[model samples]
Target chain A: MNILIKITYDGTNFHGFQLQPDERTVEGELNKGLAKTLNKEVKIFYAGRTDRGVHALGQYANFYSDTTIDIGNLPKVINFNLPEDVSVVDAKYVPEDFHARYDARLKKYRYVVHLSRYRNALLLNKAYEYPYKVDPDRMRKALSYLIGEHDFNSFMGKGAVVKDSIRTIDKIDVIEEGDFLYLDFVAKSFLKNMIRIVTGTALEIGRGQREIEYMKEALKMKKRKAAGPTAPACGLYLVDVKY
Target chain B: MNILIKITYDGTNFHGFQLQPDERTVEGELNKGLAKTLNKEVKIFYAGRTDRGVHALGQYANFYSDTTIDIGNLPKVINFNLPEDVSVVDAKYVPEDFHARYDARLKKYRYVVHLSRYRNALLLNKAYEYPYKVDPDRMRKALSYLIGEHDFNSFMGKGAVVKDSIRTIDKIDVIEEGDFLYLDFVAKSFLKNMIRIVTGTALEIGRGQREIEYMKEALKMKKRKAAGPTAPACGLYLVDVKY
Candidate 1:
């Protein structure tokens, strides 16, 4: 059966979501766990990849295995071999022809910033400690400039190798809860470092280091150097995906 | 000078709050840090000691140092020798007669319960995951019976090393946010494993497995077996101590 699984992982202990030669990865653990449960080598597919230290609250993926594993028991069987940092939240049977990556859907990413002067022990590795004052209202005004389709070449990092720089952003929201500031991005697809770069630029504007119009000017310039530094990967999280 | 330091720690990585012969502890780190900065061994006193795997968000402690370290720089100096899991959030120079343990007027403990069917990856070892359904209202009702001055021998664990069983609870509040239930306990002091035992017993009453009258019966009976099992240390946190 082709089984689709929803997973949540703490990426602090992982090198990244993708596989590396010697380093431990989320995909590596999933492959190992799947192999043990299916009693054979099994390949898995995922919705997207996260950078090092990036967490995931709702990441989707799928795998095909020959066994009569029931839907309710899939999570238990796969988790038997998985570690504590990685866990399967939901599992279901998908069509044989379905592809997890190619499926048309919108992805939602959430970035968290700890606005406290001191770091929090309870939220270590879960949110980035900015330690700087940022006005959420100003940040929201800056986010409004990127609500529609645009070439986000300025926000894309230099390490990104994507040929298509144009992506549609359905929504951008800045929410504050307690000492945390959350940035939520809804998009069909995101270029490498797109969300982090936007967050960094908006934070600069919120700090009054840059004018609000800088966001529009940076987009028109289409230069990575014109944008702010990339935010830390620890603050980013793959929160949801809608198909 | 008597230095007052407020600390926060993730106890999952340490043995406990107090020092041991060889094992790592919060007091051991403080002593090491203070000794390195002051160029001499310094004894550290704390408001209370937490069990292994229990965390602290606002634990108070004090140490005497002859070195003239600035109040603003003391946290930095002490944290230099400490581990990543333990951090000094606030530091100040207090009067020479001030004591962290004896002079405290109130101590507050917070216990978190993740009321969900599955474990949360982001909160591992930070909150207890309870799969079964529980009624917070019932638990609060049960908690009211244990408030005020009472002899808590029935709720104290077997490892308790205290001569006085009578303690006064100033306040008890139960608040639920999202999928987590927070139980805040305020008291001048507590016995060994007292909060955990009370939490476990109250949880049973909340689950309807036992009646609320069990709380009154347990206190009058003054037997450890009369109470419920000791809850895990991960969910209990020393959140606040006021002098």
Candidate 2:
């Protein structure tokens, strides 16, 4: 059977989502738990890779297995072998050729910025504490410039080796809840550090340190240095993916 | 100067809120941070002590310090000395006779119960996952039996050394948000493990394992064994202390 599993993880202690030989990674741990649960060597395909300290609420993975365990009990059974920070929330039989990464879909990501004057201990490693003054209206105006397809070279992270910098951003929503501001991004796929860079630049605009037109100017520059600083990975979360 | 500080903490890694000789505790970390920030041998009086794995959103403490640091910047200064899991959110000058514990008018606590079919990795150590089916109406009815003044001996934990078990529960609110249930308790003070036991019993009522009238019967019995099991400490939070 081809099994597609839904996952949720707190990525504070993970190096990232990809596998590493010596370092701890989400894929590494998932492989371990799958091995222990299935009692066999199994290679898995993950939906996407997240940066270090970036959490995921609805990451997906797929693998082939011959186990006869009840489908309803799969998540609980697999969770017993997984660590507390990561769990398989769901499992289901999918088309034999379904691919976790190559299946065409839209992805939603959320970046949380804490606007409180004091750092919140409860939100440690879960949000970026940006204590400076900000206006969400300014941020919304700045973000409007990035809607639709664009060459995201200016927003891509340094050391990225992607040949194609063109990506389509379907929408960006700036939501304020209590003392935190949430930036929700919907896209087919995101470039490395694209959302973080956009968040940083929008924050600069929100603070009145940069004009609203700066976002458009930076995108046109087509250079990483033209964009604002990359926001920390802790504030980012892979909210979900739709196939 | 007499300073009153409001704190927030993630209690997963600590022994509890009280100071212990060798165990890592919230009070130990607070004392360490306060001493380093004030540069003096400082003693603090906490509003209350929470059990291990019980978090605090607005825990308060008071201390006498002669430091000249600006009041507005004190939380930031002390936060630098504290670990990531505990933070001082606010600090203010108060009268010398003020006491964190005795001067409190009421206390509020929240107990969260996760009712999902599967465990949520993000809510690990943050909620009690009870997969059994539950009825909020039944739980509410069970909770109503404990309102107002009561001798809560049946709900107190083992090894408690208090001479009196008489306490007043000002209110108990049963709130359901998504797949989680929140029980908010308002009282001047509480017996050890009182909320957890009440939650466990109420959950039994919610699941039909026991009838709603069992709650009143247990209270009247005034014996610890008459109540249900004590829920885990992770679901409990010291929401705030009112002065």
TM-score of chain A of 1: 0.97
TM-score per candidate, in order?
0.93, 0.97
How many Å off is the CA of A61 in candidate 1?
Answer: 1.3
User: Which stretch of 10 consecutive residues in model 2 chain B shows the poorest summed lDDT?
Assistant: B32-41
Q: Candidate 2 DockQ category? A: medium
List model 1 lDDT by residue over A96-190, tens digit each: 98777888489999999988666666677888887689888888988898989999999987777787899899999999998789999999899
Compared with the true structure, model 2 gives a TM-score of 0.97
Name the candidate that leads on TM-score. Answer: 2
lDDT of 2 by residue, A135-172 (tens): 99999998998999999999999888787999999999
Question: Which structure among the candidates has the greatest lDDT?
Answer: 2
Every candidate's lDDT: 0.87, 0.93
Segments in model 2 whose C-alpha atoms lie over 4 Å from true places: none
Model 1 Cα shift for residue B94 (angstroms) = 3.0
